[model samples]
Target: MPVDNHDHDHQDRFEERLGEALHQAGGAYETDRRALVAAGETRGHRLLLRRRAAVVAGVASVALVGLGGALLVPGGDDGRQSVATGAKTPVASATPKASYTGDELIGILEKLLPRGEFSSPQARGTDDRLPPYAQVVHDDGKGKAAVAVGFDRVLPGSEQARQTVECPDKVLTPYDGCVVSRLSDGSALRIFQGYEYPDRRADTKLWTADLVTPKGQHVSVSEWNAAAEKGAPVSRAEPPLSPARLRTLATAAAWLGVVDAIPVDPKAPTAAPAQPSGIDGGAIASTLVSLLPKGVKVVARSGPDSGYAYVVVDDGKGRSLVQINVQPNMSDVEDQLFGAGAETLADGTKVVTHKEPGEKGGAGVVMWTADTLRTDGFRVVVSAFNSGSQETAATRDAPALTTKQLRAIALSAKWRGLG
Candidate 1:
């Protein structure tokens, strides 16, 4: 997968906040900061794949991750009770001394679990300068399982928060079940049962619960049948936790203080402002459908609000996937996206085409793209895949639409009105 430096920077901010929170919590658990950052970058890249798939589903308009809150200390007659369902501990204040240490947080998590034998436990405390994380290998006699919890925040009132709790479009996410609920405290929670990968290429089942407080504190918990996220063999019928337990773990009041202790980084760059609004995604899909060659038939399309749209079309041969991105005032990067070998129209529109192997690595799949930038900076780039989805094997010999047809659609005057 390609790494977007801008997105990587955003992920770094999240990691920094998490590390700061862990350090404030004060724990014996410690690891090299460089290793942590490297691991985070790998995970962030995988997450971007999911985020991009969400975009195709029309739910992700803005970037998804952000930072906020401090750490929460375990509290109760017994620290474990504070994390139990219906425990109702008071929300933690912003004082660092009052929060639980990393060791205490891990103990609290262990106590909250059902009867099970836990091994290979790992945790980062509230006082560690690394993102807070806890993982345990659990065996209930039936089988061993892996469960983990992570902490972070969302940009309040942004599309990121909304997408965090929104149930994914089934076609894009391929989950067995998913539900989104609102708590009495006005926090949003979503529980999803799905595969570790969206395409279900592997048998590792992933079940996750995500909670976002009204104030932007975000907590996520995930479990897999295998001991690791990938490669490990499935060790049980399903993940160790039920949906209700997942919710309780994510919303535990014990985390509130830790979230409160996370100090914002003065040196971190402010999130880039949302790009200048673009033409609606639905309009783009509709226009592309309208311009399809006579024999081509549109099968499915995405909504207009996503800034990009795709259509599955068939033309007697087989189904193919064609997608387009529409942007306004993108002249700043025209030189980079369209380099040498580009063609310039009499009207000052620059066009470029490329035939490359599929990005998803689907066998025998090919991608043909047409990119266009007008004199006024309006840009339209279109690409077609020989497969129905980039992640799947090719369903046809080639894209349903030829390169000439794609270029014609990209350069059409109709796109100018979209600006």
Candidate 2:
């Protein structure tokens, strides 16, 4: 895909853990359900809980294979229920001692959803993984859609919690609408209406609600106009749930109980990863603007996001989106990123250039990139897209900045002082 190895490394870590969980549970289930579980693992990469620096999907659903079996039964007005089959229990914690069966979690989801005929139900329970979730193909007489809910825990005042509610930049993620608010219980909620494909290659709509409580309980609900997140035809005008309904489903008391059931990871890190002390995004953007070829004017720019920045520029033709990622101590992945055909500067710097189609799926979009690494393991990668936003169709034949201009920007000496 010609993506940065550093970002791919983060995604790999998450996928590896999820793969282990699925492999352990695949044997006990029917083949169809097992496939459903695998689909969820693949879709999990798009969840909003991931690091923004990685450029994953802005919002999506996650499904995981539950570890053990459970007996299903019809339940009250909400939905069906299931009782765990085994006696294996999780370690004790102060949050809540209750455990849930995969079927029980699915039952809870049905209860929260508007009256609908649900099929292909799949889920993971508190006894299975850190973040448990449920998915169902639902039809409310309008059309078939896929609805899901996932639960996890984040530190109350942590960066993850904050980012969970923050709206992603429109330049990076194209969306119809988004709002973040504080609930009565001091929880934060974000309701997002966006496309299933950021580039809008398909008309499928994706709507999501994310709620983070003061006690670290995180619940997210997502629905798609189609029966699947990817590779499915659009089956309706919109997702089955409205913004209000998504809010109600995600904040249900039943979900709080499920989130409470998740076991605490004794080895989990207590804080966010530390970054280079002075690596400021604002400085990076300013430096990029300063290095631009004459006559190229900056139109819009990103805020001071630490270690990442972008600018939309025009040179009398069309707007182009340029972005940079500056990182320190990345020599560990040097071999993986700069393999053969990479150039070496006299000062022990490795440089590589790429001309390829855009990765974000924007139609007719192209991307030009320059990646450089210094002897101190400092890395700077800059990319210029033919379109001002990756989620939109291309507006020009080429980016405002040529590959040589991009290379000059990446190799500029100014980035050294910023970090």
Highest lDDT against the true fold, candidate: 2
- The candidate scoring highest on TM-score is 1
TM-score of candidate 1 versus the correct structure, residues matched by position: 0.76
Every model: Cα RMSD to truth: 10.0, 12.3
lDDT of 1 at 206: 82
Local error of candidate 2 at residue 89 (angstroms): 30
Provide TM-scores for the models. 0.76, 0.75
lDDT for 92 (candidate 1): 46
The true-structure Cα RMSD of candidate 1 reads: 10.0
lDDT (CA) for every model shown? 0.62, 0.65
In the predicted model 2, the residue pairs found to clash are: 78-111
- Error (Å) of candidate 1 at residue 368 is 2.0
Worst 10 residues of 2 by lDDT: 60-69
> How do the residues 1-419 of candidate 2 rate in per-residue lDDT, one tens digit apiece?
11122234322332222212222334222223112111111111221112332222222111111111111222222111222222112222344547888888888788878897998776767886435777788999998998878777766554455566556666777777765555544566667787766778789787877776667677777789988766679889999988767877776767777877877777665663443353677888888889999998898887666666788999899999987777777676577567788999899999988887776668999888888889998888888889998768999999999889888988988888887
Give lDDT tens digits, candidate 1, residues 1-419: 01122134323322332322333334222333221111111211112222445412223222223222221222222111112123222254444444455566567678877888987676655444555666677887878887777676555645556666655543234567655555545566667777765556778888877777767777777788877666678888899899878877777766666666555556533453454455788888888888888998887665444456778888878879887877666676666666778899998899888788765556788888888889887778788888777666788989998899999998888877776
